[model samples]
Target: MARAPRIEIARGTTFDQLMLWLDDMLAAFAHLPPDKHGTP
Candidate 1:
């Protein structure tokens, strides 16, 4: 059997921080214009 990757979080992290990070990433992606260069 293969072992799963181990994940760890800092003790002081909060839910609000996680949500804020996600929002920031989504906002960045939303601002990008559609790809007019070529068909993928």
Candidate 2:
């Protein structure tokens, strides 16, 4: 069986910092090619 990855955030992280991080992550995925099987 496989375990889900754990994500940890710093104690003092601000909302703006979190948003910027999310935007970066989304932008990173924007370049990915679509799945041929139509499944995520």
Candidate 3:
């Protein structure tokens, strides 16, 4: 099986919700140590 590995919002999802999720993800990453950012 082949597929692009990425976060996929389902069809008909709202743009605002996606943006909010992305913002939260960024915030979570911002506090991590530099070396911990590469995987997981």
Best by lDDT: 3
Cα lDDT tens digits, model 3, 2-21, are 98877668876699989998
| RMSD vs true structure, all candidates | 6.1, 4.6, 5.0
- Measured against the true structure, the TM-scores of the candidates, in listed sequence, are 0.54, 0.56, 0.52
Q: Could you give the candidate ranking by TM-score, starting with the highest?
A: 2, 1, 3
Model 1, which residues run further than 4 Å from truth? 1-11, 36-40
Query: What residue pairs are clashing in model 2?
Result: none
List the global CA lDDT of all models.
Answer: 0.67, 0.73, 0.83
- Candidate 1 residue 36 C-alpha distance from true site, Å: 7.4
For 1-40, candidate 1 gives per-residue lDDT tens digits of: 9987653336666889878878887887776765843324
Which candidate, 1 or 2, has the higher TM-score?
A: 2
Rank ordering of all candidates by lDDT, starting from the highest: 3, 2, 1
Please give the lDDT score for candidate 2.
Answer: 0.73
> Which model is ahead, 1 or 3, in terms of TM-score?
1
